[model samples]
Target: MTATVVVGAGISGLSAAHQLATETSDTIIVCDAAPRLGGKLHRLALDDPADLDQGPDLVDGRCGDPALPFTVDVGAESMLARRPEGLELITALGLDDHRVHPTTARAQAFLDGRITPLPPSNMGVPTDLEALGGFLSDAGLRRARAEVDHEAPALAGDVSIGSYVADRFGDEVTDRLLEPMLGGVYAGQSRRLSFEAVHPGLFAAARQGGSLLAAAQQVAAAAKRSNDQSVGSAPPVFAGLIGGVSGVITALEDDLRSRGVAIRSSTTVREIRREPGVDHGGRFTLVTGPVPAPELITADRVVLATPAAPTARLLRALAPEAATALAEIPYASMAVITFVLADAELSGSGLLVPPGELPTIKAFTYSSNKWDWIADRAAAGFGAGTAVVRASVGRFGEEQLLQVDDHELARRTLAEARAVPGWQSARPLRTRVQRWGGGLPQYLVGHRDRIQTIRSAVAAVGGIAVAGAYLDGVGLPSCIAAARRAVADL
Candidate 1:
């Protein structure tokens, strides 16, 4: 029997292995550098309220009960339901009944020292300018209204999102509106991010040379029409499991184990080399483990489901051009601070903080208010007056802000949360801080072209393919889609 090796046991690699197992008879093996399996899809168990004083590290297993009532996702909380990959995988794992959607509560944005309702927008590009009265200043609103009059030729090539939006609307729109939305998703800077990679629909519309306001309105109308035409009342924009999004990883792991796939952790692939004139058993040899005594594994096929830097290192000798292109991709680091508060009620689902508006936190998610399951679990676990909230900090080029220890980080984030309009009286019961260093990949200008170059070079090398959040999109579904494509390519 032939064998295949998948490096990096994140969602992408695991998904690839599952596909290969289901379709072919190849002996599958997955290896990850970290001791844990799940990459960004991490669920942290909250200590029982009785053990609050013990500390964050003393989890439920050590304290009161192993089955903690409240467990929250520190990475991604939801997946885009519009994409079929995530939902299909969930269904395949027999988790359809466990699926849940966010409540009707809308999100808010903190601007000018006040929390205001977020206007109807296509990714922060306001579709309804009339709704932005209080959100924008008088002069800023006028400039935004004058977007139709600004005449310009069709877009020639890729450009930064901030530059394009500011040219059409104004600086305020980019700063107050666009920056916060993009930051929440990528922890990246708007001016440095690519327009083509971030907003492909808007980029295509801009290529025709017309009013962007009108283009945004048309796009929103198209989306509404598509939803109305669906078989039933339109599906929710996002979906999550009853317990946490990390439950998907758990279910996936169980399914993989049943298929007889080998899952190994704390085993890093140091390098990959292709042997010339070898065609019988396997051509690619994977060097893994420590430099002192590295272990070698042979495979007929290989899938690289890792971040840009490590992927570059592995492909340096085999595909230098691809490695060089992958190395150019940059990454951003951020931290998520989860707080369990007693005797407090938050109004909206969450509030986003534009850069410079707050000291550290860029956004806050009222988890108890957003998901019914979380509310029920929190009330049952702790008490009726308890609540759960998550505050996100750091951004691209803002590594210094996260250099402090966890205690200092949590203290700073909680202090800012109290200053928010409705959270002044929140008393912290338990707090957990999760830092993801070099977590998100930044799609700089001409990112599409760079991706093309990397893919072409890797294809030329043969017997190997790359998949990650950096390729197509940063969402869970996108990573899965990239993994499936890599499997198909092989």
Candidate 2:
């Protein structure tokens, strides 16, 4: 029987493997170093069994669309509805019922030892020069705006996002606003990220306007127009599961299994080799290990969906050109500490933090207040507000990831949170820590060219491909979409 070997049992791998099984009638085996699946898409049912949350809850992109779950995406909360791949998958999977939106509860960024509302301008683009900075001088803001272009650049070349931002807006904007914003997104230092790859739109806009500041103004106005159109939209919220973030995962995994998809957890694949055969070309062989020292399963194709580092290693022998290109991408480790408190604690909405606000906390999410899942628990409290707030330890590779243990991190977060006027009254009902050593992938400025080369180099190989958040967009929608793209090739 023809089979497909998929490395990494994460969502991307799993989804592609499932498609391979259904489309080609091929037996598919998904392998990962970890016992469980889901990659960065994690759902949790903490000490409170009733409440389910996304650690650092990822937000949903279909914030206003109905005909779905009215998804309250709080954990890892983000969606690139702009992308086509994910939306297509949702329709294919018949998850139209699962789609939904969560309440944003207003976002704010902390910097210079104070919390300020992040401008609600489109895509965080500054519409007016006055909106440039509490940090930059008037002249600096004007100069920065004069440099921005209004269109996004293509993936034809490579440039550091820092260089692009500096050339367009000056060093102050790059260091303070953009760097921190990107840090929160990619968890990598901006200097290393390529601007052409990461923010193509901003790059093009800068080129058009001769400055990012000017591009921001035009983009901001356009964005405002879009926002006005979406104002009275239905669901008008971010999407998530009815219970906790895990609810959807549990349901989806079980559904996949019901369709005859077998998930073998805690398994590892030592290596993938080509089996020379005349029956149907050369079959791809996967050497099973940690089970048998050298037992092998031959397959028709293979999908390398692991993180960039491991992917680089796997393709080294089969497609060295592709492997080397894959190796160029870098990763940043991250840790999350979740503090679930009673209603008496969380006084209001959530908060964001800009870069340079160090030594204590990086970002905090008012879980109980943002989504109905946690809010229901908060409402159940002793006539006061108790909520779950997540504190991220590192953005630009901070020491907190290495320096603090669970208790210490908790203590530090609690104390630092008190410094924020709204959350001072909040205390944890339960606490937990989730650390991802190589959790997030940083998209550097040269990222596009490097990835393009990697993809091109790998394409020369037959029946082999790669897909993940790192390849496409860096959000849930992107991940889902990437998985679908891999399936199309199969």
Q: Provide TM-scores for the models.
A: 0.96, 0.83
TM-score (C-alpha) between model 2 and the true structure = 0.83
lDDT of 1 at 247: 89
- For all candidates in order, the CA lDDT equals 0.87, 0.61
Give the alpha carbon lDDT tens digit for every residue of 398-443 in model 2: 5445566656655666666666666555545555666677777778
Provide the lowest-lDDT 10-residue window in model 2: 57-66
TM-score of 1: 0.96
Give me the runs in candidate 1 sitting further than 4 Å from their true place: 49-68, 279-282
Error of 2 at 220 (Å): 5.3
Q: Candidate 1, after superposition: displacement of residue 340 in Å?
A: 0.4
Q: Any idea what lDDT model 1 has? A: 0.87
